[model samples]
Target: MTWVKLFLGSLAVSLSLVATAASMPDGCNCFCVIAGRNTTVDGSVMLAHNEDDSGEMMLNMYAVPRLNGNNAYLWGEFPGTSVCDHFLNEWGVAIASDGCPSREDREDVTDGGVLYEVRLTVAQRAHSAREAVKIIGHLVETRGYQASGRTYVIADPHEGWICSVVKGRHWVAKRIADDEVMALPNNYIIDEVNLADTLNCYGARDVETYARERGWYDPERDGRFSFKKAYCDPYYYTYEHNVIRQLCAQQYLTGRNDLVPDPDTLPFAVRPNRKIGLADLMQIMQCHGENSEHKFVYKRERPWNHPVGICTDVTVLSAIFQLRADRPREVGCVMWVCAGRPCTEHYIPWYLGISRTPDCWRRYASAAQAVKDHFTAVEHKRDQWPHHIYWKGVDRWASYATDWHNGIAAVQQARDKRQAKACKAFAKMDKKLQKYYDPRTLQVKDREAMVKSINAFTEKLYR
Candidate 1:
């Protein structure tokens, strides 16, 4: 009887762990525009991302040190994980990823590092877009890419690259053309990789051979080895939401009415008719599929249309990285981060050179410590006081907006007015700081002042 009870308890614990792992949230979207394709309104290359996950997860900012004595990198990390979904390093390298689950993922569960681990490794070690591609390829081939597939958008001031990692360590990456712009939802976009174009393409040595062994490709019948057709789970291709989002992205970028959503024929990248800017990117990220007649309708009965929008229920944070090569490193890179839903929340600029995060943005170790700190700074008692002040406030505001439902239009109008005013003020302050302070002469006090000013502005938005 004692042995039977012990065995039952162990079995229950094992099942609980499996259930928890299976429920992990997954979804994200990222877009990149090269320098030539940008409007130069801010004189920088831009990359934007929408990080969707379990709505309850707390998204916090982190500055992690590189073990190899390189420059420390700043990233927006979720609680309990060292892997960063969005990150920018001192060398102007910035990267973001989207989840791409495939059929092969179910069969291949080797020792390759998980998604977060692979992302963290790339963020810590790579300095250039090309270097980042090589590093990810090497890591996947050697250690194995353990998670479902993923698509990474890595960029610097000079260029951008899209790398796709699949199950069993097979991967491929292609550099975005100088004048091209590309966007990725939760699916593999890279098709036939050109092995001969070493400068622009990188892939595993056994990519084709492995696909052949798996009976996924036929060299004699299929003219060339198509990565997407071979590795992307056929079931995902049937998902209407994936196709809807991909179509929406292309329509937004190209502004072409004739374009249709066909996975087989959609170009990986294209040159927009008009140069895109940071503001344009923001609008795209905030898209709710409004213009499409086939998708979301303003007051339609289809609740499914909600998930197809760029802004979704589970979006915890969104950001756009502006990397300027002409400006000094300290002031050149800026991350425009929105704590909650992009549609309701405005972006706050955080400079890459900042030494410390504002108290509100920093996460504490425990609830007790958070309370103690709150008491120490009692002046902020009227505002948020707990350890997760920033997150809690954002969550509350997001809830209010969401609950408004059909009445959200009024809320958005008010928020947009305030956001516009705030944007103007931030632009003025950023310009003044850029002109007044030289990176070489900037002191700790200057940085502190900047942080305080930004924090105050952010607090005003919540109020």
Candidate 2:
């Protein structure tokens, strides 16, 4: 059966067929159902719509992940309350006053056989009931029921916030940098190649081309698009966030047995023709890096533990892989990928463009919490180095870098006439390092010598 017919049929069984058609918003996402679809092997059909005055973008039939659940919906607006510090599991657009509810068995309002509802809210009266139905109806038709996933839209001078669609689904609501706030940045320009495609990776020149067209990178700058600039854009980063978040949530929801109906019952459909798995998702999450390959090398040239770099392509592949085979153990490993080091702090501020790093985010919590868990896994094993060797080497190296950075900061602070006692202490330390160690270059000339000194301690201890 055709997916469009199947979806309409499903709705017919739950609601008045005429009502279903009449109730649908003019332009909202649709969730198509088809036979032999909704598995990694067979695949499912998707109908998504982007409703903006600028354009109405819609995808009629695209293969969607199996774990997306049995019911689908088309939704564009979300209504809820904001609960700061509330822990939401799935990444979607929604507002709640408290974090994700601890209970997963909450009731859902039904429409067209699908389950949904307004779980929490602040200004419920301000948001019209008709709009709520339209939003829910639109969502159900498109994405199906994402357990904790939601998308929100707001009105007026305060624009909506775009959350990070990566590991945590946190907000991406900040203005980039001061310079780029009103200008187009490197990633915004529509070019010969569609930037929204999950699989597209253009070379620096193509990136430069896009930036130049957008006025983000002018060759006149020394950084050559490397330096950060500001530009106000609603579409570029918005699409990036939404696409990645939906894909990642799908990967997790469909792949893990933890989410299955029963321990014995298989939850998702799979496609036999493809290779999809956790490793693939890991690669996808790191797709933003400059590496030609999607692979994230931790021990190589630029070993960034890029938790945020993972993208939609990676998430889609993972969802497909997990649907094909139900692996609870593998899910645990995927959890490790999020919460473990060097996954947490490695990508913060640098890759995320986040100005503030929350203390909770920096510290590791639980493997189940995914990328936020950092304490459990140590990237560098202490046993790998001799006991005293690591201590002496690391401590000395830290002291050196601290002294250098402090020296620079001190000079700048002094020039600004904002010197404090702490700055003076660091300044004094910097002078000592300069006198003892050459200030010509900041790096230690012979790290090997330091290692040799530590090795002597190890030899003596063992001998």
- Name the runs in model 2 displaced over 4 angstroms: 1-273, 290-308, 311-337, 340-463
> What is the number of residue pairs that collide in model 1?
1
Q: Who wins the lDDT comparison? A: 1
RMSD of each: 8.1, 25.4
Per residue, candidate 1 scores C-alpha lDDT tens digits across 1-463 of 2212222323222222211112223233332333332544655777788876642455556555443454567767554332225778877788877766666744343342444445555666678878888877876676566566777888887778888888667899988776767777777778888888998999998888988988888899787888888888775554455666666767877777776667777777777777777777777777767656447323333222234377765566778887776655546777888777777777777667654455555555432343123213323332433566555645565566545467567767976886687678767766766643565644333655665555555455445
All candidates' TM-scores?
0.80, 0.20
User: Which candidate number maximizes TM-score?
Assistant: 1
Where does model 1 exceed 4 Å of error?
Answer: 1-40, 65-68, 81-84, 105-114, 296-308, 365-387, 401-405, 436-463
Candidate 2 residue-wise lDDT, 253-343, digit = tens: 2332232211112211222223333323333332333232222222222222222333311111111111111211111001111111111
